[model samples]
Target: MAVDDSSTDPDGGSESESSASGPSRSPSDSVSAVARSVADPILEIRDTTVAFNMDRGESRVLDDVTLDIERKEIIGIVGESGSGKSMFASALLDAVVEPGVLTGDITYHPTPDESIDLLNLSKRELRDLRWEEISMVFQGAMSSWNPTMTIRGHFEETLDAHDADYVAGMERAHELLSDLYLDPERVLSSYPHELSGGMKQRALIALSMVLEPRVLVMDEPTAALDLLMQRSILKLLKEVQSKYEITMVFITHDLPLVAELADRLAVMYAFQFAEVGPTETILRDAAHPYTRSLLNATPNLDADVDEMKPIPGSSPDPVNAPVGCSYHPRCPLATEQCVEQDPPFFDAGPNHQTACFHWEEAAEEIPFSLPEQTDREASR
Candidate 1:
């Protein structure tokens, strides 16, 4: 609700009508149009996998990881911690490290004919893209800010990287803070510790905009803040997305934020996407066992005391994956087939996809089953 109203930019009018020039498609159809417009693709990931080959053994951190980000859309990636939530974010920037062998396709298209495999890019290449084409606002965003650096300088560094105009950068940064309900002058002068948790998070967001990256990956950007701050940040993000016309990939376990802010969502489990779809459709009618568990796990503020639902069992261990459907061990509707065969993503509904053997049959049963509180704790 906040996102829709807050975005004021020409492109940010929530779900602005798709142009007739592009086949008269609606905003909902933007994903396909975006993919088509690019000569190759803006951000493409297909059947990508990442493995961690530690001394003990080779552990697949991500299996068949894939997703695409288009221009001017916000896609939310949701999952519990250790579900490889943050790892997926790092992998997008080709930041996964030694002992971590990446075998995935992460390509970014700056021009219709220019595409670079982000996974294989050198440090200099990545440096060029940083803050310009694909920037990140990391988790613990507040602490990431230098306690010694003034907020203005931190914001300036991003602009300075690309030799953007210094005076214009400060002016735009001030406007951003004001749009987010932050005091421009105060925030500009404040250090990390001097600002409130929410302010710091928003400042980090403002910093990411200096170079106007085509896509911005935000991992739990407001995890440590309060509900008010969370909503404020979500609103600010919507506004920023509109004003800057940047495609966003929002990572979090916060269903409320997904419901409130994201147009589309990608569900992650054990380092891969279990499901992804339009936000409302995914939340109200999840088709993945992990996703259902996450929804059922979300504590409903409107529910009666006795009606709260949570998932059962712990998340599967990524290091030692279970045989067959990784979620079978914890899935309520898992069958023998589920145990022997891993589920690949299939069409669950219009614009919805899932990787579960019994999604169709089990969808009806999951909503009624109350679960153990810790099963899929969406812990930030």
Candidate 2:
């Protein structure tokens, strides 16, 4: 299980402080244990919380988000629109625009003794880190690219910012375009509006990879596209991951898509992670009520589409969220205790955990047969 530290609620109380006082082992201990087990961890986001200051005061967008990202694995962050998935991605690069304050620590460890605290880095340092060590592919191509700038212009701007060689930058651009199955000459000469949506998205990805960043953070990389286009992009993404071995953080609202691509998944709701675990375990036997609800609500192609189950009630307001477990308001297994105190992430199984207080009961109520082991292994 993960720990939440240096993160407080809107009421000024530390959310994980109470858990530390419990008789269980310390959260740091658990984190260390997991750290020792993994061969390589590229990024460690510990108890990270982001709050935006609004006219109505401060609104907490992300609450105590903690997770360890492996060196060469794809991590999918799934949630509804207002669940703070984008905020968490922005916080990773310390790129949350303005009027937002981030607390806790986001450490990037390229090596064992070289743990760099991203939140404490100076502006100059963060700029250097952006494209070299980490890069982000924003949601839409229209918003990500400047209309007046040609694809080549965007590449020139990015390379120039990093003080890289212009000739090498152009060469790398062509290389990436070929990798994504785009015509280098045509794409380089075209403006943002001149290209199709899928082409523009491919260009955006190529731009992010120009610097060969080790970590790629993508926010809805395949939104606003047809099924064929989406599949093409997904196939390209899988190829990119295998070839470059770059660790990726894929953020999206689509659970099934993530399950197909990512090795692990984190289900976010009410500005917090309802469940975080291996994708197979999560899909087959989700321990949290919210996770189960999301799977149930998803459109299952294998089963009848009419049997879809939608979760009741809208997400809670970030400014004035409910006390205790945020999902207790809508969770079918919610008890009086669940509504009174926040539940810490409890261990459910190997490399899996849930923030539900009554996970056993919930698991029993929403049990699912695991997919075939051979198919699961082949997918991974």
Candidate 3:
């Protein structure tokens, strides 16, 4: 998966639209295609919610997020900064801390016949699950590493914690770093601060894969890196995914970067999933207004400056979300029904689902068009 330099704008802006256009396909068609294609699911998340006992009150960070992660596939979870993308990733590993209440079924299928509910596991059981069955490459490689410890020490610590064979684990680490195009000997001997940002990121990725977990959750793997480094990391991730046959849950806000790597895209807004579907289907024809707005807001190389429109307003306060639809205040197709009543997941296409009452209307509207009169009144 070679990332085209032109896919991203020079200014480090977000997602870009695909140039190839085909005949219009209804959202319903996409739904069916996805259902038929995704036969094997590794993780089944149902009504997963995360809330904090804040001083102000209970603040919901993740609200009823439900999705099926297929085996050996790359799924991109894209959203704004406070949209609970990272929280959702943490919940997968049961890593949420004190004052944070995480509730819901996160069923992991270790085998076709065996299923384990991660949230129901005991502390010891959950600890065993981490790094062995499910591993995570957290955001910000520099911060994730301990400046005092060498890279070799990090691997040794993880291996020792897991009771893995020391010699074999080090061998695995060397192989992974070499595969990632890093000098294993030097990287292993170097401290966190000794390596560059990109090197640290690649090293972090190598460390995460040393265990060879069945599932890998990467939160902003390429953050704070230059365009070239970002591209290299994306390409390396694709290779890793192919070589290991690992199921990856990629969390990032950069749609274009995810678009290049993911087989499916899950769009998050206001701590809830706005849309989930195949990458090409969502990119070509988004059913949710928020999804459409995000695509419209993306900077396009061929389009004029005026063509790029930022999403109006900001994400709603999680502590005090809007009455009905969280996005109603900013959605162009929002209606009185949207404001007063929460919308359920509607079938937009084959395997595609969106939480929007006016999905049909959104599908018919042109991208980046001005908001409707009702939207203006709702915002006011």
Report the number of the highest-lDDT candidate: 2
Tell me the lDDT of candidate 3: 0.76
What TM-score does each of the candidates earn? 0.83, 0.88, 0.86
Backbone clashes in each candidate structure, one number apiece?
0, 0, 13
Sort by TM-score, best first: what order? 2, 3, 1
C-alpha local distance difference test of each model: 0.68, 0.77, 0.76
Off by over 4 Å in 2: 1-37, 367-380
Which is the winner by TM-score between candidate 2 and candidate 3?
A: 2
Off by over 4 Å in 1: 1-41, 111-113, 368-380
Per-residue lDDT of candidate 2, residues 32-97 (tens digit): 433432457788877788887777677888877777788888989998778777788888899876
Worst 10 residues of 3 by lDDT: 1-10
